[model samples]
Target: MNIIVTRPKEDGSPLKEKLETMGHRVILMPLLRIVPRPRAFIRKLPYQAIVITSANGIRALSGHTELKSIRMLTVGPQSMKAAKEAGFLKVEAHGDLVGLATHIRKTLNLTAGP
Candidate 1:
């Protein structure tokens, strides 16, 4: 079967390869382009934990090895894997925004520091 993947190049390329391995014809038609902001501009805030929703966030936070000590909550498996690869000691994976919010509320002391 022929499949058209419309994800970004970074994400679509992997899916294309996987499909080819499965003997499916995958045409990668990347519709989105990621323009990463300056990594230096990203700084750690005074928060108890860090919440990341995208794998790109990991790339953006590159070189901040000290941040690996902070607890991290990611939106999906990909984000979780990225966090782990980035050497985050404490990482939680959630499926969606609501789940992530619930986890934060249950785990974090909201009345405390930001």
Candidate 2:
């Protein structure tokens, strides 16, 4: 069997190696590349909450102590996990962006800083 894995390199490499061991040829062609922001470039700003769509976003905010005190909204389980691991006390996970937006509108007061 020949398999084409279009996931990112960090995600597809493990599956590719596993399939090769199982007698299948695997092509690890990542469909998108993740360009990480410089660590020093990101700092805590005046915001009520931070919305993170991916685990990478949590990773990018690592080492910023000021972010731990704010609310963290994650798009999925993976992002939620990352936010938790990063020591965010207030973390909420939504299934998708639409749901996240709905949750935000329902629970968050717009008068507060966003």
Candidate 3:
């Protein structure tokens, strides 16, 4: 079977390897690209925690020193793994966006989303 994996170029490689190993032809086209914002250091400002929706975001934000102090919140298991690999010590996987938002809201005692 032919399977198409739509993810960022950095992340698609691993999925391609897995699908090819499973006997499927995989086509990889990155759906997104990471271009650091102009004021990359702005994210360094203090916040209650860090919210990561994608492994790419984790990778993108890894270079910032401020992330080291914030609690890591990931939307999925894969993202959590990425967060850890990117050097986040206190990683938490909340399943999905809504779940992460709920978890963050409950954990931080706030009514806002993660």
Q: Which residue segments of model 3 deviate by more than 4 Å?
A: 43-46, 111-114
Model 1 poorest 10 in a row by lDDT:
37-46
lDDT of 3 by residue, 2-112 (tens): 988888778899989999999999999888777756536553344668788887678778887666667988899999888888888888899888999899768884644
lDDT per model vs. reference: 0.85, 0.83, 0.80
What is the Cα-based TM-score of model 1? 0.79
Candidate 2, residues 3-111, lDDT tens digits: the string is 9999779767877998999999899999988877666655446787888987767877877877787888889787788789889888999899999999889988888
Question: In order, how many clashes per candidate?
Answer: 1, 0, 0
Model 3 is weakest, by summed lDDT over 10 consecutive residues, at 37-46
Better of 1 and 3 by lDDT: 1
Error of 1 at 75 (Å): 1.6
**What lDDT is reached at residue 96 by model 1?**
88
Ranking by lDDT: 1, 2, 3
Q: What is the lDDT of residue 49 in candidate 1?
A: 92
Which residues of candidate 1, in runs, are more than 4 Å off?
A: 21-23, 42-45
Ranking by TM-score: 1, 3, 2
TM-score winner between candidates 1 and 2: 1
